[model samples]
Target chain A: MTGRGDGIRPRPDAAAAYGAMLAEQLRQGGLAEPRVRVVVADLLDHVRTTGEDPVQAFGQPADYARAWVRPLSRWRVLGRAVATAVGAVGMFAAVTAFFRGGSWSARMSVTIGDLVVLAVFALGAGVLPWTLELWLGHRAARRVGRRPRVPDVVIRAGVMLLVLGLLFTVFTAFDPEVWEPVVLGPPRPVVFVVGMVVAAVLSMVRQPRSPALPRLPGTPERWWERTPGRPGRRRR
Target chain B: MIVAVVVAREDRESQWLKGVLDLAVLAALVREGSAYGYGLLRSLAEAGLTGLKGGTLYPLLGRLEDDGLVRSEWVTGSSGPPRRYFFVTAAGRAELEAGRAGWGAFAARMSTALEG
Candidate 1:
């Protein structure tokens, strides 16, 4: 099928592996799903038509993805943190409700210790993307004839996990009298849905590029009239 | 020694192509009106980037797509699965024009120096 390698066909497994990894890497890089779909389709078509083994054509999926899309964009990181916070609150509610025999939808109390725990969870969620990227980077690098220091990242991740564990223990161990807020937060379901919605909205929001001047490349950052509906840019 | 020679040649070709591969892909799209991913690579190969692989080329296509330079759509013909065909946008044409001028000046200077 290809000019150089006529009549060759790609192994189905290789094509599948390449396509899946490319899609994942692209998604993690913060390209929206539809864009990711189209980009992946284009690459797969190239492989099918050219009859090139996916590996022969693409060195490593993560490396190829990094070349195309900058991973761990700010918007994606925010979305992740919000999603994790929502999950943590839901789990905490479920456990408490099970123990106290209370309705799952009951309103939650806002203790300072709870806030501390929530913040710790959200912070952990925020760093999750970077952690995943490091793992992917190490694997991709090793496969592609490059050696990255994997143990250092492993050590760092272990330390972070231990720190998170210590924080969780300390916060939960504090007595209820220490810092319970007087006000009760919203009911569980509403808060959970709202948090999820906020996370969804965050993922969709584009981080604004540095405002390009009307004239050219280099200019001071100036706030111009922003276009409606698009939250990212302030271009005239 | 043989593996080293091959790796060196590969690196040299990619390094030289790095600056212009995206531009060349853009030029091919502008010239052809529209083409699929593999078809575009074939055109590049015919234009002397014969060793260009899909791995290198797709990322360039992706960057072009992201920059609003080229737009793509899926088309299904009588056979095979649907393929994405890319068309150069108006902005892409403007960028290509600017690139053409830049390349011409740079190539002329390099040519003069190499022959001198």
Candidate 2:
């Protein structure tokens, strides 16, 4: 990946990049998308108009967002992490059931390889991205004099892809195709039912509360599904 | 060295604004009747709240609007993207007055204490 030197001028998209970064942080913090859009627009309007470097203006996007969005407690983060993990596992089981096409009582055709794949998929899809984002974003918020470079972002993304690719490649090389497929037999009803129930409960009960959107003009109140009488976490 | 100093100064200014920003913002809206974001920044800077970032101000405006203290709408600009202009609601004006009086008394007390 390469970076443009502002066409020998300077990186012109810094403000935009910062806005995108901040918007992502806010969304991850449970802010609604429309509210995020409005926030980003307001940020860009001022920065673009003034020709201000966003880092200089806001220190770090992540830091500013953390302060502005009200940091979630550690338990809340843990709950979200749990939800993502359980959801991924449940999804894998559902997909397996779909492909195998049998009654719920049928001994599921799951391999040790399938289990490996599921673990890798769960860690990759459910665990890694947001965990890294939260950790790195939190740390970066503390350091100043950071510059937004397209190449830097591209490289980080590429490294992440490489890691995931490497994991899949390793899992495939041991691809039970070469050996007697290690068979984990009979999907027991108790474990299966419990897993499904836990997943269902977590999915329903542990949803990251959608931050309430401030009543923006031209938008109707009927559109948002706030709980009856309890306004969602006041749009911090 | 120079950049560090500038950054440090800006940090100090922003820290000062941190506590009083929402109040200042509310006061600004009431005083101007209405203003867009950039216009608000300009007004605040002129009033000695320099080095305040858009990151700091915009979110507070949003929170204020969210809380029903101020309201905003997108208006077409002569150039560039449309701007969202904000106005203090009656509630917002009322909030500004109460906050203003409270802040004034606090500041006076601080000044007296500092002189001692």
**What is candidate 2's CA lDDT for residue A151?**
39
Residue ranges of candidate 2 with Cα displaced over 4 Å: A1-12, A72-74, A101-106, A109-117, A133-236, B1-19, B107-116
Interface RMSD of each: 6.2, 10.0
Q: Write the per-residue lDDT of candidate 2 for residues A117-145, one digit (tens) a residue.
A: 77777776555645665665554444435
Question: Top model by DockQ, which number?
Answer: 2
Candidate 1 lDDT over residue span B16-65, tens digit each: 78888878999888777898877787787778878777777766776687
As a TM-score, model 2 comes out at 0.66
TM-score of each: 0.60, 0.66
lDDT for residue B14 in candidate 2, whole number 0-100: 66
Candidate 1 segments whose C-alpha is farther than 4 A from its true place: A1-7, A73-86, A102-236, B1-13, B90-98
Q: Candidate 1 DockQ score?
A: 0.37
